[model samples]
Target: MSANLLPSPMSDPIEFNNSIDLSDIGGTLTLAETTHDAWLPPEPVNTFEWLCENMHSHKGAPFNPVQFPWTKGICEAWDDPRTRNIWVKMGSRLGKTEVSLGCHACAQRHDPNTGMIGASTQRLLEKTIGDRFYGMMAKTPALADLCPPKHRQNSHKVSTRTFITYGAWSGSPTTLGDIDPKYVNLLEVSKWVREQKSESDSIELALARGSEIPDRKFLGESTPTIKGACRITKFVERASNEYFHVPCPHCNHHQRLRRNTTGERKDGGLMWDGGPEEAISPEKAYQTAHYVCESCHKNIDETQRRSMIQKGVWCGTGQRVDKNGELVGKPANGIRERSFNLSRMYGWTFTFADYARAYIESLSLSGQSFANDWEGEAWVPLKVEMEWEQLAKRLCVGDWELGQVPEGCYFLTCAVDVQVDHFVCATFGWDNRQRGCLIRHGTVDTWDQVREWIQRPYEALDGGSDMRARMTLIDSRDGNRKDEIINFCRSVNDEAGPHVYPSMGGNHGSMNLRFFRKLAIDADNEIGKKAKRNIVPGIHLIMINTTVFQEWMDNVMVNRVPGDDMSMMLPQCLIEDQDLFDQLLNEKLNKEKGIWEHIDTLVPNDMRDVFRYGRCAAEVLTNGNWARIPKHRPRQLPESEADRHQRQRRTAEQLNRNRESGGKPNQSKKRFVRRPSSTSSKRFVRRKSL
Candidate 1:
């Protein structure tokens, strides 16, 4: 949809676009002629005549002349005889409310005798779909004109009514089953699916209600959350080609897009801006180039993608032709699906300004109220400053995998967390020989800094042998930084000399509390139990174990001075010859109590966690006696006499058996009865072997 097509503040629909041939978009009948007489009552040529000029009885509202074009498109889809279901997948601020509101208006207009249902995950529904759309009938004069006099007895119908009828309107996710409706509008179907079917739930019941209505239409709409979780993903998978296929520019190939197919490039990269430049265009040109056809292997371009796709109709490989002169598939009586990003709907014209504006718009007071009503349905909150920083930090460190390598050379991992505006990264280096028993660490706030640290390790290590280096873990925790990490790793991996391996390592990475503790304990006992499992034994490496390292860290904490505030620990720790503490204090403000009221509190970074964990592993692996000894028990197990007696008994029995049988005896089954032999001074009597 172009900016020109945006819904105006006024309620009237824009001019009819007869210029658009429904044939191109695959509509069965141009909106006017498609619906059966049962669905669409004959258009009232003169409203005064239809109601006998009774203006006072109806909500005292005159019909608005212009029609809502967006609503018309949506309603047309709803009324289409071939469409059993429709899924509207969109993003924020694209006039989606009108689509639902218009459908409601149309449904009410068709059958004052029939009931229609609008549902959301919660009665509040994640977004303002129900609230906004329900309000539209009263707020928008055009929609108000469609309601029967009985449905709106007074001007304040929405306020007084429990339903969108003559009765009071009471809408709730819980009450959907009470008032059975003809047309069911399930907002955020995917969310409803998730909640209702969370564990051992019967979500299929909710999803299946519309199908039970004799010839009911089900409309589902939502902005995608995760890839597979969205109801739209399922819809798109089964949607007809006429409804989804977009044309390629050069060869005129039609491509049906689902989750993975849309905007894909021939070189196994994204056709959009974020992916790698294809072989055809390395200059970073935004224009669509030759697209190898997914079906025919023919080359295509942007022009073709537009020409082959139809907006409203569906198609398939060998399905029968519909009345619209396009290949059509079975009308899905069940769930019909379609999904596209808000950017794609707007012709992919998103700019940073647009993103920022959206970010801000979502935070306004009204937006916050709306969000709360929708169960805080916003995927990314606009008031995400703290969250953004946290995300940035996580992104910087999510997938950084560290390993103990060999020699003086160590493997280093670095990553940057990205937020709306800032990024942070921590770097880790491990010795290869001791399987990351020893680790060196650093932290930087930028990708360039990480790159520098990754490259600089070569200078610190001696000889060309150091060039062999172990794995270099990286945090690709954030989706935004996946390309950044992948590209960085690719470049580093491509370089000569030391190999840089990129693995995901973070607080949530494979290196957990247990691994860290093991690392710490392994430091003293080089051949400790933990080392036997994950680490190659007897290698020299620098790896921090988390458990023992945490113990070491507990000693590092400084209490505030007596009669001092809790805001003075950082500077004290920093000034106390701890480089890590100094770095942390410098990075943040002092906020601890006691004598160190003026000093900053030392906090753990991604590196700190890694260091501690590595230390634990090291302590455990190097000195099992010291590291493995439980603090409370603190003792070794002594072998009991029973162990020696059992060994001796087994050996003597074997020798006696061998002597009796001349070292070979055939197995035999025999039954024997023995009488207890009495001994003068013994707890038991021994019997000789027969």
Candidate 2:
């Protein structure tokens, strides 16, 4: 407060610094220690400069534009008068999050305006705040007043000195209107989720919050999630899609850096020494990877790539630059949004070999992730499609009647879909030649009826013995009586072998490339351990990768794939089941996500699901060795109706006993019984209960 002494420089912006400082008159200044820029009058600078001067990486490294030159223009665009929105659709580990965070900090410190970071979810909001506003506040002393000492982080919102708050994704359209923000950041937008249908997506709502402010800035950042349903895709399409053009080391040609391992090296692609396409291995791809310049027709090694990328410039997709670094073609006019598409090809950490190896590995896995992660491109779906009505009309293949068992049926499998009040079930029969038929499709309500369906013996029409479903899979997903399904399967499995299993379709996150996986739901519960059970009983739910199997089913039907005796035996008897046909047609592959989803979310697709499950059951039984499946045996005398009734009674009684025993083996009891002695005389004898 004294005028005689020098005033203090800028205070702690992160946790709040109140230390006062003195000028040259206070003490002999030395070059050994640097002075705080806050002590002097503030100088004008762009967002990137402010970031370099004020912020440091989480690891305490100073921000350097030369090291990460790709971020220079992107950060500068935050203060561009002509640009209102900026989108960076780039590969992983390319400093997308850091740049967005840097811009947010710059807006709060340099401009002193209200800002909001719209994270994909509440968890990401925590990561943004705790990791910076709370976690790294001490390290970033220049931002002393960034956040409160004990941040509560209530509902993903934070109250700070500069009024920088955070918001979560919302579909209501009105949620983002809570507070007007001058700067907005849509972070990891591809992961955002909505409760239900909305008039506007979360990105649009978040962007609209700062639309009216003339000096507003918006930063949209994400990897491409789905082909057509991505937020970054919208940003890039509306803007001038720019590709980073690096000068070729061989010919000094400024061309867009790309990868192409398909053709010869002379054709100009990401050339590597994977000699043959079929024999290409990751090792070979990585050890001899190099980029062939389009102009020079020469290889650009990793050493050249590092230096060239530093001098590279971002050019619009439609624009071109010649070998002499001269503009050859003009970009489209009147583009408002500034967008950039980057891939791992330009990354500093990864060598050409590393990039090629990763790409090859991704191709072997799904043939899609490389585009999404490394190429930063949306996955384009290219596969077969089907017309359900047309397929249904061609159901007159062979005389394999639907109700009657197909001739020489080797094995049977049943799949059920649980409905609100009833259960939809389908049983399929398969022969040794891999020919399968849809034997029965109907709906039943009671568990007893499900047991009957599973246990019902079908006499093979080709003078073969009776057959029963080798395996039965029930859909226990979407909160649809999962516990009940497990219990029913357990009771049946206890009486029979491991023929029945509780199964469900897995979500994208959990489902792997495999057709099915067994997930142990009951890891600790040892209900039957005390009884020395035959097999340690535990709830191991079978999770089906419906996407994979369903896609396979579509290809099998439409393309006649796996066509070595693999046939979908259609019968005229099933032609009358219009509901089944409609349900079978209900599903369509969502090319955007590379998954098969229902065309109509509301309509019933139970029979279609049942069919898919039937296919899955057949797969589980066949596994890998088709030879393991025994051929149909010779015909035997069919069980009489009385014998069948007795067997059913026994099964029902066993199921009841198993349930009553609480997963333990039933105990025995002693009883007095009358025994025949001599001639018709009866005698009382002690006997154990059978």
Candidate 3:
């Protein structure tokens, strides 16, 4: 249960075997026996057997003993005194939380008086460790049996034990200061310690409180965050002081190994392509796999590396010694088990198929899956397929109107779609109040032409207008186009009247339906209110999916079965989305329901981008900072029948008052006068001012 205390009953009689197998020994050995025989048991000892034998619990017990196989790393850590902290950077579905819980339970069983702590992210601690893990304590007979009744205390907020009277405490990191722990189990170390952004992280709090408890230990484990500048890196640096040295086979010289910086070759060259392939099998030779040596330019054999290696435990800034008694720089603390460690335990006897089954069942229950619904197969095996076509007509429209040139038009916006060779530019015009069509040019604008187009109004304008361009929205989705687009937008800042805005919503012709919902709504609303202007002022342009739109118009099926004629019946011209089209084609028709159900639910990449872009545009348009003119305010008509009658009554009152006070009733003096219209068609008469 505790690090220093080993169960004697199971370990003392452990057979000396290099295989370290823990199998076929059930429910007999006691803790005292394990402690007696655990002193550096040689290979074939079946460490797995010894562990399982020691872990055998009484039948019909209130609790089940934590019965997972003891990893080599955990066993090695138990032996090393220098390794005050063991950091496990594991992958997903590795039972990290179970490891923490089982380790605590194991420690409790071994040493009833030893103290320990369990810490994780506050949210995880509450929802998972407290809620889920504690729930197991009640359900697991082995765990209940192992936990003495007096020591166990369960509650809604927490479930605690005093196994080794005040030896360990379990809580969130923030609460670590209150629980003085001898051994600390830091759960999800990446998220808890490495990914922390504030001073209040559990690691910091643990360190602060750790000094109070002398002779303390730490276990930090989680799936890696991968990103640099995380707490795991700091932990690695701190733990790097201890070295595990192995003798060189050729020279018989004991030398410590340091984990060299990855990606940089010893020759000062860089790895531009993929790094070394992952080692899938632990029994496979490690040296022969992908490692390179800087000393002799020779690769070491894996079998030899495994034979000569000792899992060395290191502490702070410790030095190493060679066979000649010469001092060497500090090296990495050699890991006994790494990525492939889990592969070894999969088929072992101690590996309960039931546990694995439960884990898989939990994942399915949580609505998690590794497979794609389409093809009824794994998602990772999903394939990419593409089709390309060109159409003469533009699929999307610009904002500018060529037939009617409105006066006092000041702002214009451009949306430029960048291709490998040429860019497609669509422009829109707005007067800070109303929006209209501007101009659209495709695959024709050279970089210079684009520059001029963005800087000033189109030369093809119907009137000789002097108003300069307002805003230009350029596309920069491609990493290659970023520099050019950014430079172009920056260059025309002073020349253009409006800001150069970069737009990222359109998905070219690749299933992009950026404004599908927004465009479908009728513009009409409450007429009494002033027109709501688009907040993101300037031209609204998007890369027209002319090909996809045409395909939709033609009701053409993309990769659909020839026998499936449902989507074929729908006209393609009105459909704006190819992803939707493809999705609909895969639906299964139920005659009884008279409806089609999707055969597979999958989120397409194009749809994701489209949603992202739509969200970005929505944020910009509805941010509530539209410009308004004080003097040229538009007249608002009243709403509601009662309000209209009230206005007419007020108008009558004003006219009667004017008639009573004037020498003669003036016909020109009318209340609530309407202004003259500018359009050529005199559709409505205007009343004179009162």
Candidate 4:
């Protein structure tokens, strides 16, 4: 062989013969043997290299990792044995579907286990499996050669919902429960709708299909939708949230890429040269666009992108610190879900200029689109309506304690919301100028506890004078406690300083209408009336337009102008509680329903409701007259009839003057009016004014 090897081109090719004896030259391989070994293809060590060697695009070109370096970590996570569930919350056109297809191909080739892939709908299911998955298998020679003769003979079998050769099935979430697979891939999970009567959620149902298998794998990828409702976001929150961190070319400081609207230096957000207004014309914006290095404040051109990405790594931010403040690292002891988040800002296929143009164009079109597509963030509806930080700015350093009433407070009102286990009360003090302060807010275990707390005198912060809530409104919406609330209000006699009223919220069409409407007498007996009149005779039920008051609260909290009468003031102590602020801001206007509702159903807005009820109580007690009321003086004990008669004459004259000044006999122009004692009124004789 050594004599003839150099001369014979016609001899059987030695490279193709696997039976050639090379064991004699195996020790560190001789130079000629090393040269011969180089001719054979090296086995791929990882899934990414396997994909590159085997998978191909629709055009029959082998997969290129250089084009999308961001996928390296994603592929590594998929192959990682420690990572049981993988979630990718990413922007559109980032090759998520291709990665999923590669995973499917890998599962089919290596393990040969049953697997499943799901789309949002059946039509999408058919298109993905038939066009994308099949196209990849047909175009790639390695994957195509692995197909059995039956799969090659009948192409229809490979295109259908059930591809038996690969032991894989494809369907929508609604139909995924029937199949039992070891591997599961959910595509565009945000678009998967919940079945009306299904016991399990769409994601749960899909996961259940693979529950019997010990070596199960789950992968979910989607462009996120509404914040709370987004499945992908929820998964990312539970997983080891990993972000691709690339080093700054100039400073070498690593950071995740973010699009910045505010021109702050430390935020590490993507910065542009011009203002948002200049970005109105996308083409012009694209011409001048470049990413600013977060650490060095230097300009990063598109030319440096490839090098920066090559050195990038995925940093897990989901780790928690131990008691000693040490990093916990990846969650190896738990369920081991690994999540990856990416945006178009880091994509190589699209230039930074293209990202700027797309973001700028989307700003005028839809804010949701800009958030979901460009920023790769969840879509949050009506973000401008109420912001916790904006409301926090309304905090004032008033000279008042938590429960003490301020100097200008003329009247006090308490609003109570009844929950299953506790009553949430918000006590507010209002001045004649319509300025208000949160006197106190807390939870009481029972209605009796709430009544006792409400009746207790609250001392004035400025002076030592005492004040009590003039009116308390208890929400009677809970059917279980409605009767209890009504009975309690009825039993509280008029002698009590604070008169309790049962309040029920109503959703009327108009916002400018009366804040509270008294339930009509025998309203339930009327032909067209749907209002209930089952309360005790003395107890009055007030129908409150809660939506209007919520809007008012929102306006006062957000668009408040200094010195405006409608502007509200929060004490420094209460405003510092971020939990309270979040509770108040958790609700948003449902434009379609024309009402204010909680953005997330789990977040309680009891504080917001209490505040609304307190405002309503203020309006009802004052009878829309918020003008300053004259402070009452202490009544002098008359020593003689002459003095008493003189006092009566003065009182009659004052009454006549008040009547002539366009004031109703019972109504006061001020928010708080002092009334004469019933004993003094019965004893004194009213004489004509002289």
> Per-residue alpha-carbon lDDT of model 1 for 1-690, expressed as tens digits?
222323466867555432334454454343443333333334423322222222121234432212111233345556665566666655544444445544545555444333443433333342233345344454555455553344434321222222352111122334444444556665544444333323322234344554656556666665443333334545644653223344444344444432123455443212334342122222233333233555555554444333333332333434444334454555443224322222232222332223322322222112322221121132222111222232223222212223222233233333333334443443333332222212234446655455455544332222222222233444344556554555554444444323332233222112322222222112222323444323322222233322223323322232212112111111111122344443322222111100112122454354344443333333333332222322231222443568646755764565465456543323322344233334445534344465
Candidate 4 C-alpha RMSD relative to the actual structure: 20.8
> CA lDDT of each candidate?
0.36, 0.68, 0.38, 0.67
lDDT winner: 2
Location of the lowest summed lDDT over 10 successive residues in candidate 2: 523-532
**Which ranges in model 4 have alpha carbons more than 4 Å from their true place?**
1-45, 146-174, 276-281, 318-328, 331-335, 383-690
Tens digits of lDDT, candidate 3, 1-690: 213233477566544333332344432333455454455542223222233444322222232123233244454463354545565543344444555554555554444334444444445555544444455544454455544343444321333453431221233434565665655666655444332455565566665555455345566665433234234434644554233344555554544433233545462111122333221111222212333344443444444544444322222244555555355664344432121112111212212222222222212111112111101111111122322211111222222333222343344445555667766654543433222233333344466666545544343233443334454556666756654564444434423235554444322112222222121101121111232332222223233232222222222223222122111122123235354334323433232222224445662223222222322322244231234423232333435578656755864564455345531222433344323445646644566444
Cα RMSD (Å) per model? 28.5, 11.4, 24.5, 20.8
Candidate 2 similarity to native, TM-score: 0.63
Cα lDDT of candidate 4 equals 0.67
Displacement of residue 645 (Cα, Å) in model 4 is 87
Best by TM-score: 2
C-alpha displacement of 32 in model 1, angstroms?
29
Cα lDDT of model 2 by residue, 178-296, tens digit: 77788888777666664447766677778788688987888888877567766677778778787888888777878777777457666686877745543466778888888898777
Each prediction's TM-score against the native?
Answer: 0.36, 0.63, 0.33, 0.48
Q: After best superposition, candidate 4 residue 481: deviation in angstroms? A: 50
TM-score of candidate 3 to 2 decimals: 0.33
Number of residue pairs clashing in candidate 3, backbone atoms closer than 3 angstroms, sequence gap of 3 or more or interchain: 69
